[model samples]
Target: MLLVTGITGHTGKYFLKELINNKYQGVIRCVVRETSDTSLLDNSGLNIEKVVGNLNDKSFVEQIMPGVEAIMHIYNIHHSPVIVETAIKNKVKRAILVHTTGIYSNFKYASQEYKNVEQKVFELTKQKECPTKVTILRPTMIYGDICDSNMSKFIKMVDKLRVIPVINKGESLLQPVNARDLGKAFFNVLLSPTETSGKVYDLSGEKPIKMIEVFRIISKEFNRQTTFVSVPLSLGELLAKSIKIITLGRINYVEKVQRMGEDRSYSHINARNDFGYNPMSLEEGIRIEVKEYLEAKDIR
Candidate 1:
């Protein structure tokens, strides 16, 4: 069985689809929390085995680890320690861990929660030869047809604000990989665990573009005359820190925005050489996101 954690997330749903569509030739088990949204899995005609429990639960994870051939651990929650322990204890053959560039970008600025979870992964992986091989995929900003990404968020904000905000004259660079490409990267990791083991693959788009240029794409796509208001990174950081405390449980949108407004691009040569992973260009990904956004708004 292929156990996929974070099965209800943005990329998780598509990960399930690729596994099913490619006829992975095994049972696809999804580890989900109590409040996880699994509606997308309904009527997908998949050989799915749903395992409902906190992946952070040592006992619960142990129960699911045994007899599983491979594990696609795609969560950033508090599940790393338990997952690593259970995988080793059960001698699970492979563990394809889906991490993000957040591990790098947010290394200094990341919330304690993200840091703890990330540090735990490295610590556990350092223990005992690790019965399972670990493939870590650090994906860049991801956008897709169903995405409400930074671009889409701005488009939505345009509905409210006559101006769009940019940090440091919108000079920060971003390279967004499409959801399908990200899903394919996950699938590719599974097929070539040895090549990817103990390696961090930074999956990115073909090119990195500036933030202001990105906003231009949004404006052109939505046909909005949204003005650009640039601010310094220091001010943005101050706002992010303040907002981080104010909105406790939310996704920390400010910190997330600040992270995006920072440049962190890398070579995909490793992904391509290791598993033939080729992502869509930023232009194409943007077009797809725009097309989907328009369709959803019924505006075109």
Candidate 2:
């Protein structure tokens, strides 16, 4: 039996599809919110049981741990410690937490939260008392499909705007792993639990490109000869701060603006060496995403 959290999320859906496509016949259970759309899972014809609840409910989390061999936690990192702890109490043998490579990027609140959750997972492996084995998979900017927030936003904006904004030449490097590739990585790690146990690997795209190149790729995908406007990083940061204030901290564009000027590139050597995690290039990923976007909107 296997338990998957955030089963309706981007990577979660792909992970489920990978499991079914591989003829996995094990019992699968998903923990999701009451409002999450389950059409993705419903259309797949996979035998999966859905438990409607929030992850923060400790008792509810414990109730679903019995007879579960492994857990693929692909949701909020903040609840990882509680989930792992509960998994331990129920004697779940294997666990995989889908974290982010942003922890290795420019240090910020989000990175700190990821780091804290990772530490909690690691501490479990060292607890000579518990028999549960944990693996952490950190993926760089996950992009692919229209559901992705990374390049999809750029593609939408470039389709509507005359001029696309680029921060400080947008030279900062980015290596975005396709969500499907990340899903495969998760499956691979589950296949070799012992070999990947107590280890953390960075899952990234095959190639890294400049930020400006990302904007150009989106423009090219939309067939738009849009002008790229290079704005000063300082000015962009100021605007982001101003927006944050206007939105009453509802939107933190400051972090997004700051990250634009910092390299988010990461090495996938460990992931490749460990689980043969070879991801598609940014261009190919973007092409597939554009096709999906166009199809979804009935534009192409």
Candidate 3:
């Protein structure tokens, strides 16, 4: 049996779609929260078993690990240590984990926890007698459709407000991976466990582009004339803090502004060489996202 987690989330949903599209013949089981919406899984014609529980609970994880031969954990990286320990204890053979490139971020507040959790997982899997072969995939910022948390909000903001605020004139580079490409990567890794096991791969986009180019692409997609306003790094940080204080901590953009000035590009050459991984260009992916956004807007 194959076990999957985060089946209802942004990237997980795409991974599930890949499995369905390929007509996977294995029995698959997914762990989801009680409040998670399973309409997608229900509508899928694949045979899948749904278990309602949290991965943080040791007993709950143990109960589900008995017959699971391989686990595809698409959930938060923080839960990886627990899952790795339980999978090792249960003697599961192979495991695939979805992590992030954010662990390399210079932002201490956000990157510290990710680094710590990933460290624990690495230690567990590198033990002398460890039986499970674990492969880790670190994807860059994921954006594909309306469900994405990153570019979707940016798209909406650009559509509604034609003026974009930038720090350091938005020159920092970013390479975002589309959710569809990421899903296909997961499926490819699952198929080639021998080649991917005990290795880490960076799943990035076709190439890195400047933040200003991103804005221009979105504006071109919408066919709207947009204006770019530049803000000094220090002044932008001050305004972000002021906004947070004014909203009584409800809205926080301090880290968001800080990260905008940092480069977030990575290479997927190893992934391409190992698993034949290829991702779509940012322009093509953004076009799809903009289409989805416009269609949804028309519906409402």
Candidate 4:
């Protein structure tokens, strides 16, 4: 049996689709929160067991680990230590952890926690007696649909507003992997356990593109001419701080503006060679996102 978490989330949904499409002949168990909508799983027509509980609860995770031979942990990297410890105790064979490339961020405040959790995971799996073989797949910014938080926001903003604000003249490079591509990567890695276990793969996009070009792509998809206003780093930070204060800490973009100046690009050559991982180009991916956004909002 294969245990999957976050199966209802944006990427997880796609992963589940891949499993169904590929005819994975295994009993699948999914861990979900009490409030998570399981309509998709209910209609998926697969023999799946839905266990509702918090992954942070060790006892809850332990109870579900009895028959689960493999695990696809797709949510909350912070909860990985618990999952790893439990998987080890349960003697699970293989575990695929979905982590983020944000661990490489230059911003210490954001990257420190990821580093700490990853360090713990590394230490846990290094023990000689550890039974579970772990594979960590770190994806760059994930974007493909309206459910995503990254490009969807940009798509909505670009569609609604004619003038877009850009930090550092929007020259910083970003390589965002599509959610479906990441989902396929998970499925491929799961099948090729021999090559993926005890390995780390960076699932990046086909190539890097400038941040300004990202906005421009959405504009072109909508067939609209958009104006980009260059906002200096210092000024952007100041405005973000002011917004946070005025909103009583409800709105905060101070760190986002700061990080916008840093280039975030990673190579996935190793992933391609090992698991046949291939990601779509940004132009094509953004067009899909725009179509989804338009359909969701019923906009022409």
Candidate 5:
């Protein structure tokens, strides 16, 4: 049986769909909050046992950890250390943590936090005293659904803004992995538990594209002649900081502006070699996202 957390999220839903499409024989135990929408799982028509509870609760996690061959934890990095520890205690064979490639970036808060989590998990799993093998997958900017943060936000921005802004000539590159492909990568890692164990893989798209080209792609998808304004990074950071103050820290102004000038592209060679992580092209992926967005918004 496989224990999956965050089965209702964008990636989780896709992962469950992949598991169903591939006809995975294992019984899946999904741990989600009581109020989480299980419609995706309900419609999946796969072998799934739903557990409604908080993963932060040690007792609840410990109770469900036994007899589970592998665990794919897709959310809540803060709770991962405890979850991995419990899995080790219960003799679970393998654990896969779906992290983000942002950890490798210059973002201060998120990078430090993810680094801590990675360090903790790796240190624990490396101990000969611990039996449960752990594998970590870091996926770059995921974008395939209306619920995604990267392309979806770009789609909405391009849909609204008369003149879209591109910071630092938008020269920084991004390689976005489709959420569906990320799900497949998780499944592949699960199948080759021994091969992927104790390893960290960076899952990204096939090619890195400039941010300017990204905006062009989205604009093309929207079928709108949008004007591009190349804003200086320093000025953008100033505006972002001001907005941050006005928004009462609701947004990450520094990270957002700084990341605009830094390349976010990463190599997926290791993941491809280990687990056959083949992601769709950015153009095709964004086209799918645009189609879905148009359908959802009832717009042609």
Candidate 6:
């Protein structure tokens, strides 16, 4: 039995579907909050055993840990470590920890709580001497049509707002990975036996390109005209910090976003080499994203 947390999220849906589509002959159970809205996952019915409970509930969760084989951990928050600790205590075979590449690029953009969660996971993994071999993956700037977050927000604004905020030639590097390349990743990691234990993989598409070029290609595809503004990197950071204050700390999203300028580019060869996990290029991804975004807007 492979237990998957965060099973209701975008990446989790794709991962679970991929597992079932490829015909993995194993029981796949999905963790969900008791109050979680299951309308989105209605398509992937009965196959997904919706384990209802919050991550905070340790005792009730422990009851279901008996027959568990391995766990695909798509969780990242601090409270989520409870699941891993329990998984380890229950002697689950393997754990695939889905982490973020913010540990590298734009790490400064991360809130103190985010990094704390990562550290706690690592520490718990070390302390338990847990029998479950743990593997970590860092996925950066993940996107698709359903998203209006991060770069997707910029993509949606291109046609509506003629002018866009572009920085320093608008060429910051981006390695946007599609959600589909996730199937083989978890399967392969589970197949690695013990070699994958305690290993962390930085996952991304093979090619990382400049953000300006990415926007330009998408703009041309959509017949959108966009004006660019040059904001100094330092000014961008200051603006972000100010937004954090002006919004009474509720709108610190820019504080984290502006940090994307630092080393946004990375090589996914490691992920490719490890589990044959290769993501599609930015062009192919954008083509799909823009098409969907346009179609959805038409219906709206």
> Model 1: residues >4 Å from true position, as ranges?
33-40, 106-108, 111-119, 145-149, 237-261
State the RMSD for candidate 5: 1.6
Kindly list the per-residue Cα lDDT of model 2 for residues 112-169, writing each as its tens digit: 8777878877787678788788888888888888888897897788778988789988
For model 3, state the Cα shift of residue 115 in Å. 1.0
Task: Look at candidate 4 and give me any clashing residue pairs.
Answer: none
Q: Model 2 Cα displacement at 210 (Å)?
A: 0.4
lDDT of 1 at 29: 82
- Report the Cα lDDT for residue 274, model 1: 89
Write down the TM-score for model 6.
0.88
The runs of at least 3 residues in candidate 2 whose Cα sits more than 4 Å from the true structure, single-residue gaps closed, are 43-45
Model 1 lDDT tens row, 177-279 = 7777888889878888678887778898888888788778767766778788888877877888777788884636566656656786777898899899888
What TM-score does candidate 2 reach?
0.94
lDDT of each residue in 1-300, candidate 3, tens digit only: 899999899989989999989998877899999899999898888889999998878899888988899999999888888898999998999889999999889963869988898889889988989989999999999999998999898799789997888789989999999999999999999999889998999999999999889989999999999899988888998999999999999999998888898999999999999999999999999999999999999999
- Residue-level error in angstroms, candidate 1, position 129: 4.5
Per-residue CA lDDT of model 4 for 12-41, tens digit only, reads 999989988887787999998888989988
TM-score of 1: 0.86
Among all windows of ten consecutive residues in candidate 2, which has the lowest summed lDDT?
104-113
Error of 2 at 198 (Å): 1.1
Give one digit per residue, the lDDT tens place, for model 5 in 1-300. Answer: 899998899898888888888988868999988789998888787888988888767899988887898999998777889988888888888889988888988755689988898888877787787889888889988888899978899999888997988898889999989999988999899999767998989999889999999999999998889888999989998998988899998975787788888899999999988888889999999899999998988864
List ranges where model 3 is wrong by over 4 Å.
Answer: none
Query: Model 3: which residue pairs collide?
Result: none
Clashing pairs in model 1, backbone N/Cα/C closer than 3 A: none
